[model samples]
Target: MTVTLAADSGRLPEYPMELDSAQSQRVERLLAGTVISLHDHPIRLPDPLTAETWKLHSGQSADVFGGDAIVRSGLNVVLASALAEPDQRRLLSWAAAMRPQLLGPELSGAESLALAMRGEGSAVLLALEDLGSIGTDLVGIEELYRAGFRSAGLVYNTGNALGGGLGQSTDGGLTEPGRRAVAMLNDLHMLVDLSHVGDRTSIEAAALSTAPVVISHAGARSLWPSARMKPDDVLRAVADTGGVIGIEAAPGSTRVSADTTHDLDAVMAHVEYVAELVGVDHVGLGPDTFFGDHTQLYSAAGWSPQPVPGYERLALPDYVAGMENPAEAPRNAASWLVRRGWSDADIAKVLGANAARVLESVLR
Candidate 1:
């Protein structure tokens, strides 16, 4: 479905914040902490529909977040589609081959910790947005784990052999195969994310998984009411499992109202809502952002901005200000919390510690 673009498709205002001296000081202090992003596509993505083959924008992945305090980032393979076609499979095959070279060195859990302890940033841990690339086979999952992916989602926005997705008109929830897949992921120590899964599927996966289950990059459905956002019950289920819901800042996905400017303020509203609903410990930053105009990418790929059954469609911003890309989101998001008078300890948890605790447990 083609989502009609709003009139103002030009770049939205940048950084749109004016912090006082005290708040500026607080932001600086927060930047010194162990910031971690639970989900982000740090690398630039080419339009999958237009590209003949998979290719990323030219840059070393490590340099993408240069000097940022984000010690760990959950890098997801966002382009991996749920389609079972020969051309798509070929694209995925090429991506899998290029993974090692694109991401540089793979750091084990201990190695990453040691690096963080030494004040050097930790290596990026890879995750799959969904298990679509692997179909229903355990061997395919094992291959990905061997390739250094420590986290995965059961389904993307649509159904797979494993289960139904949020994009499906009718969700049948998890299948017997999906339950088996969840168990295998638990046994393999892979972190489970339910960001784009159907509501019933998400709740069931969280209940069945032995490990903590995250909605790695989404917001509260009650706040924005998008299909991409999680409902209260889903959020409760994840929190019950001691998991974190990483608040996302993707343009139009996390707005407070249909007409609200899709900016850092909009992103923070969802953060505040989730933190209040499930405690600060159960919230973190995901900011599934990249280095380019995300709306343009969606337009090029013929993708609609995620909308639910009842809610009015969100007006897309050219970019979500201050949270436009991975480079700016961490500090800007933390700074927004500071500006909101959130306690330092709470801000720390929301920014990184909460995610670190869950990720470390499963990755260990």
Candidate 2:
């Protein structure tokens, strides 16, 4: 009943040794309970490092998707905003303030373990926030990549020196400098995310990227022709290049009505549609669960929301009613896939494997 524990060399300076039988049994019990507790629950671990670290230290399974190794191996995250470089103290302060809203105290222990494990490299997650007025210079972007920024997008939802966003009336494609920026990202082995890029910019960036790319949090244009959703052809193009299309769970992307039942059938419909067009291997979820008043986050940073022609606001209540938080997201997604008759392997892929594969391919 002995369990051998190994530390990720990248995250831990020294590797820990094997555990004896009694320790192994305790670890197994904790893992079993955690799995059951989170079943069919959709929660977000805003910072996986804490919870992840604790899990690894305690010898519990670090794989978020129920111990699927493939899903765990390729697990990496890229944050959407790259606004300003807050001092380390400020960063810690911000995390402290956002913790309660992001990860409830009830789940803080689990989240702390996740984040700690991430720090140990059990998985990788990067924050690719929108660059502030200074914008993300090539030098800065390259440095981030070296520090592990495997994916990035130019703008959130407004025009910048790089290109126009979906909200722009002109819908200009990538600017000359933008094209150069993409190439630089490719050279740095970073995947380009086109989630909020305008249609013209998306098409151009997809075509221009030499490496695999992603629309980290988007939906199907055919389902809800909003600026946030990509067209079928665009989805096809992404898959054709060995990239992925992450179907998002945001309210706006799905057009889910406030009064509609909590049935996730509509959400599965989008997944099915994307799988039909690009095959299941190319579809994944980027359920962009905002931590707090994310709308305010964007506004404070000087960006305004555009009237997405056909999309609705994804209120917190609607989202929480369906899947309470980030940690629960994986379990809920897995169950939905299972009821849809997805094999464990296919379900695993959608839950995390597909995204992992894309990262492995591009982040090497």
Compute each candidate's TM-score over C-alphas: 0.83, 0.64
lDDT of 2 by residue, 181-220 (tens): 8898888766788877778887788898888888776768
Note the Cα lDDT for every prediction shown: 0.71, 0.52
Please list the Cα RMSD from the true structure of every candidate, rounded to 1 decimal place. 5.9, 12.9
Query: What ranges in model 1 sit over 4 Å off?
Result: 1-14, 45-104, 310-314
lDDT of 1 by residue, 228-323 (tens): 998999999999999999999887888887656888898999999998998988999888876555777666555676665565444578778888
Question: Between which residue pairs do clashes occur in model 1?
Answer: none
Q: What lDDT score is found at residue 301 in candidate 2?
A: 47
